[model samples]
Target: MAIAQSLTTTASLHYTPFIRELFDTLLTDSWCEVSSNRAIEFVEGEADVAVEKLVPYETRSEQGIFFTADDITMKIVNSLAAEVAVEKSFFDPSCGAGNLLLGIAKSYPIKKNLNRTIEYWSKKFGGCDLHDNFVIAAKLRLIALAAIRHGLPSISEGQLASFVRKFDKFYTGDYLEADVGGDFDCVVANPPFGHVVASRSNEWSSGRTQLAAIFVDKIISSGKKGQKLVAVLPDVLRSGSRYERWREKLAKETSCGAVELHGRFSKSVDVDVFILNLNNKPSVVGQIIEWVPPVTDTEGSVRLGDLFLVRVGPVVPHRLEEGDEDFPFLCAKNAPAFGVTFPEERIKFGGTKFLPPFVVVRRTSNPCDKNRLITTLVKGIEPVAVENHLVVMKPFKGGVNSCLKLIKALKDPKVTSRLNNVIRCRHLTTKSISSMVLQGV
Candidate 1:
């Protein structure tokens, strides 16, 4: 508690002595069940601390507890609340400081016409976290939000107690360890990402499991029939060798859709993220949605179906040596940048044959970046077999030119600027090549 108090105090620069003293009192209090009067006192004290510390920081700065970009959160909230008929009860399993929840709540329409809907939805919204500090922060955020919506900073003792009781919605246990009791109408979470090591008796070790894959599985398992979920997943889940079976299992178990976001949310780890949406209803075979930059004034967003092919890189056994000419490979380590360039010495001396002309995208990496696409327009090659750690995509038969167009189009400053460290490639498809040739005409 001293550590918490010190951190909070240092983080808050504009607290009055009264507010500071109140916080110091609450920080030392060990009551598991705080009285309503104490809760109100605590909230008022914390609000002063938060207000001082809540000054906006640059989008890329790490000052905020939530790492995701604000724009990303806005887009997510907009998408989730787009349809009014959908029972929109928001739930975040890893509700860190309630940022996502707060963002959603703040975005809800406050006008008289929409007040009823907002109130109805707020009552149904729920969230939970494994950290006690986060629960406290989330409750403070809710109190602050209530103050903003209404004109008072004070809640009655009973109301304050009720708020703390609901704040119990935020738990203090491992998400995977708990039963999660009832399924949510909609679940949104950003679970931890990385490799998951499970013993023989653990559920995820039937084969290799990416942390994101396991978390995705957990989200789906936590949902009841008709429940939908949106969770942030590492790019590795989309393109990792360890996720092949997991992907198949997920696809088979539920209908899934995703939106890919480049760059790390907050941490230095440059992981690619996707907003995955799943439901227990019959599979809806969702079309891939790519967020291309705006086009002409009249045409802003474009949604093309089946325009790109997605395939995984070849998997060579670990026992195989590098000199194998029969199956030349491209491991994650060898993935090239935007332009198809690799160390020639490694190519020649490493004894790996050059893959044929095809676009090779890295399947997995420690820090997922945007330049995952690799274009190989080096002429006179046909479908090349990609090695483990890379996924190759070629445009359909007539897409050679389109593929080329995509390559060139991707070279635009706008596209390339975003592509840095996120995408890479070494091959091209006939359709891609064809597309490149006919782009502006």
Candidate 2:
């Protein structure tokens, strides 16, 4: 006799009479997980009923479907409950598949300590999402998780669904538009938010609206005086000219700091992200902001500002579509350490004399790269024009050998390590790069 897989796996879903009907009715064409290790492949067809037909009148909102990694979820949960046991109400306003709820249970040992009853969980943890399908999925996942914790081999579909619907209280609605209506002690969320997905809002100035910014505004605005809001946010809020106002607001209102994470969290995404912590704690002694404040160690350190007249390249638009001239242009790609691939992204250099023997450094990179500052020495006297992607470092008084030496030195591991703190949000601005302190110039 072959052993069957347990129901604990994310993909290995236990078959239930109600579950099958729920999928057939609501999902209509979604596939169930056959095994734990295998991916839950979705085979879809024409929906028997329209999505709006299944969607109730009360629940209608935009779906930001990005989810958090398991390890990340645990870390957020652990960090939130570090000083105090999170026995109070735990919530994720934009809860997806009950991942945060699971994390909360694991961290506090809710199922282990308090009896796994609908009444207990109902009071302990609650959340809301925009999508009804996600709400259903989240509820089911929570039920399955609870079943495992309670050591129940099999749970009736009707009973499990009833408990989840009654206690979980995860209805489909816009978290920002309407209130989830909870006096939460701990709030942890990793919503689908970024600058690309940002939309204009009447509250802020023209073009000042972003999904993350709006969410942060709402989160901080509605935040109670003595609650903690932990989130995984895009690095845009950390720096950038547009978010300066929000940054000031965040600094004044709550004890906020950003801890940058390493590597890509998922397959499709490879942008730099940070753990944003805002503790609205009553106490002031333990509150402090952690960031790379502008303070260079002046003791034997040579600032890059002294050596070069650093100026960001000018905007040269329509390079490919409407270019009328050909000249050597140095972009970020051409500025590899110790060398230059000049004349590659050829653009109209115009009648301007760019000259040569200038250092070009990459203006942007992910912090995970550790050493994002790639430099190249432009030696040739070709009429060279640089793009905005590179910062042209003109020598105050130097020659070819000096530029080469600077390039070699910058590429050194020690030098890059020193510059690590100076590089913010994977961008080496003219001000930041210039402020970089070198051991020996």
lDDT (CA) per prediction: 0.49, 0.58
Name the best candidate (by lDDT). Answer: 2
Question: Which pairs of residues clash in candidate 2, taking residues 3 or more apart in a chain or in different chains?
Answer: none
Worst 10 residues of 2 by lDDT: 37-46
Q: How many pairs collide in each candidate, listed in order?
A: 45, 0
Expressed as tens digits, the lDDT of each residue in 1-441 for candidate 1 is: 343353345333232333334434433323333433554544333443343354333421232223334655666666677532354666777675566666666655443322333344446566666555455566555654554455333444444444545544556566677766235667767666545565476444554455556656777766776677767666555543444556665666666454555445534434556566666444464333332222332233222114545455445555444443333335555555555533232221232333344455444323333433345532234223345555555555444565565566544454434333222222322222222211231
Sum up the clashes in candidate 2.
0
Best by TM-score: 2
Off by over 4 Å in 2: 1-64, 83-86, 111-116, 196-209, 256-260, 281-288, 293-299, 319-329, 332-337, 340-356, 364-371, 380-384, 399-402, 415-428
lDDT of 2 by residue, 219-298 (tens): 76676776778777765556554666666666666765555443344453554456777766345534345544455576
